[model samples]
Target: MLLMMAEVLAFSRVSEALPNSTFWQFLSFHQSHVEWVGCSLHDLIQPSFSFLVGVALPFSLGSRLAKGATFGALLRHTMVRSLILILLGIFLRSMHSEQTYFTFEDTLSQIGLGYTFLFLLGFYSPRVQLIALVLILVGYWAAFALFPLPGAGFNYTLAGVTPDWQYNLQGFAAHWNKNTNFAWDFDRWFLNLFPRESTFTNNGGGYSTLSFIPTLGTMILGLFAGKTLKDNVAPNQKIKKFVITGVLLLIGGLVLHLTGVNPIVKRIWTPAWVLFSGGWCFLFLAFFYGVIDVANYKRWSFFLMVIGMNSIAAYVIADGLGAFIGNSLAIHLGQDYNLLFGLPYATLVKGALVLLIEWWILYWMYKNKIFIKI
Candidate 1:
């Protein structure tokens, strides 16, 4: 909750500081996903999320390992969790829309699928897991770039494709799930396969299908992180090594770009993108490790740690409450109360109020221990 508040405020502040009407434009830039062939701070969000999943795995699964959980127990746990996440995503996407049709391809769904794969990777040895990550990345790259786009056989370039494949995929997803895509949010193609998410390449399904790869990489890194925390490695040495390694990965990612292998496109999930963002994730881990663990700055991290402790809850609060409050309150206030405040400040005030409302919602959840989980 705290982190969400801070992140949202930082976003709005960045937008506010822009000159002229650039505030709106910059705000859009921050809120909107990046186009193909580039990385943005926004792109970091999903990977960070995936990384968080890995961070939790050891703690959660370690308990299972300790409690004498069998293979059957682990499989059941994985399946149930994935389904819950997937369904939750679909439910969130469809919540306020017309009830005539159902929707698919939500973040929850991706997280569900992604988490299942992440656990599987974490279940294995790090060496094998790393190899799997490489295969997934290289394989997806080949699938999107080398293989022709469906229905455009022998033509691989995703340029000028009308109606994103995601729509078609959702259409299929809706059918399998006994529902239909909302017209406003997606195309109504029937039985569409592989609903696309943000693509690495244009239409490449940004971390969509390809996410399983980097996601595994993210988990692998987390495993190392868990091991670090568990092991007695000197804090100072770990911090130094982490800083140096992160810097090298960042630099190496850049050097690869200079050599013209692939641009650092987040949409396409280029290997370079993985190396770069994954490097930054390492840096983030280092900072938090240094501060919270090494420096013992527990007080400062407490708020984020609260939200981080229930990170998934924060995701719902940050987005779910933001949308629900913003839409309903902004409309009611602007349409009904604008006569008093006038249009100029009425909408702005409503937006601020909505943010406050979301904060309170999260705060309430935190206080009551009413976190919604998968």
Candidate 2:
């Protein structure tokens, strides 16, 4: 969550400020989303967030059960939470629009769309979860593979893709190409069902509501990790399991990509992407789990903990309040204040100030025990 906030609040501006520096250039590459294919640090943010949701489920369910919550009660709460998350996502996306956007491609909405299924799976055995994961990935893959590609006379321009666009995949992999696959076609029909200023043609980034299916796969992988953590295994064994699983997932994703069986496109949340990104999620969990939980070296993470504990608040502030705060800073501090460091670094200066204010807000919330949980 801190990373997600930082990417918007400060990282992009800082990267822009140091355009000629190799270090910042490297950071900038990861800070921004890739156009169509492959992964960037920025791309991992959504998957990681989704994965952690699954990781938390085991603990959440245990607590609820221990509190004598019945299955019906749990189901009711999950449904309400899912609805709120979906509406919250739509609300956030519609913040600058003329009306409610009614898009389900937002991260929160995508997760919400799949959360109930994930919640139900949380109650089942690991074997069932694994089988479901396989079925989802394969079934989604087949659906796309079976969807007819655009015919020769089909106009790519209408779908926001140029005929000669460099990233357009060829052959079998084209099934997952941007704005030209099953999901894109589904959106054309599905999104148009909602009221709109104009007909919904395609998502500029090629993200689709159906991506939630594979996103559930990513979450299932996290569910496995969560179950592992809850097991009565030794710390070293847990770390080993995570590392092995991470490597295997990475290999599996790469093999599919290399063999042209599937492409690792994050935009559509392709099945291969579920495996690839899930690998990174596991490794990250292992690193943090080993460092903070296993080694008891928790002091250094308090700053991050402040934002992470109140993540929903942090997300809301980052997405909704950032421009407000930035404009206010300019209003009160003088428009030229950020230029004190020089014109090139003006964005950096302003962004840093905004980020600081955001952190302070989170810190205040932390101090007051005002976490905004869904």
Candidate 3:
């Protein structure tokens, strides 16, 4: 949630302000999404969020079941939550558009598209869940690998890729190239079914609705981790399991990419990316679990806990209210107020203020016991 807020607050502008500082530049690079074929800190944000959703499911399911909820009730709630998430994603994406943007590539919509399946899988044994994960990964990979690449006479420009586009992969890997692969073609048909300002073309960033498949795989991984944590096992065993699984996944993803069997493309949520990003997600969970839960280092995470608890609310505020808050600050404080920190730091100051206001909103929600869940 903080990372999402940072993106909205334009924290990367700090790097722009401090162009000469290598440290700031490095941080800024990670703050922004990578163009293609590589992972950045920002790239991991969506995967982490999606993965954590799966991680939380076991507890959520257990709590509701213990409260005497039936499968019918839980399934209904899951459907409703999925619908809300999908519509919410569209609404947020449409905030600046002419008509309702029907894109389903955003994080929420992508998760929503797969949440029902994830929920259904939660009822099964871990072995079944693992089987589902393998099927999803392999099936998705094969689908892409089998999709025919563009012919020589095909116009790259029509698909928004230039003839000499630097990121275009060659040979088999080209099957996952931006704007020209299976998901892109699928969206060409699927998204146009809804109302649009114009005919839907390729998503500029190559994100596709079909990515929800592998995203489900990511969630399944989280499900495994969540179950491990929730089970009556020693802390060290859980930590060990997470670490070993993380290492294996990381290596698996790298091997796939290195072998040119598949590429790790987050925009498309390629199967290899599921393994790669899932690896990082596991390691991250292990670290946090070790420090906060096992080691009892609770005090420092209070700030994060506030945001984490009200993540949906925080997400809404960050996406919906950031501009309003920034404008309000400028109205009250004067446009030049940010310049107090000098010209280069103007963006930094304004963004910092915006972040503080957003955090306070979450803090207020936390204190008042007003978490917005979906």
lDDT of 3 by residue, 155-222 (tens): 77768887578988988899999998889989989989998998887888989999999999999999
lDDT of 1 by residue, 1-374 (tens): 34334344344433454445675556546554665545666667765666666767878788888999987789788989988886777667655755412333454565676777777766787688768767866664444344322343523343323444332323212211111112211222321333434322232233233344445565566665665555567999888777876788788778766666545655434566767777787788799889988898889765565566566777777666775666776476565652355543444455556666765666677888877665
Candidate 2 per-residue lDDT, tens place, 1-374, comes to 87677764355566677677887777778878899889999999999999999999999999999999999999999999999999999999999999889899888999999999999999999999999999999999999999988889987887899757899999988888888889989899999999987889888888898999999999999999999999999999999999999999999999999999999989899889999999999999999999999999999999999989988888889999999999999999998998887876677788788888999999999999998988
TM-score of the candidate numbered 3?
0.98
Model 3 stretches astray by more than 4 angstroms: 8-11
The lowest-lDDT stretch of 10 consecutive residues in candidate 1 is 176-185
Q: How much does each candidate deviate from the true structure in C-alpha RMSD? A: 7.8, 1.2, 1.1
TM-score for each model: 0.73, 0.98, 0.98
Give the TM-score (vs. native) of candidate 1. 0.73
**What are the Cα lDDT values of the candidates?**
0.58, 0.90, 0.92
| Residue-pair clashes per candidate | 13, 0, 0
Decide which is better by TM-score, 1 or 2: 2
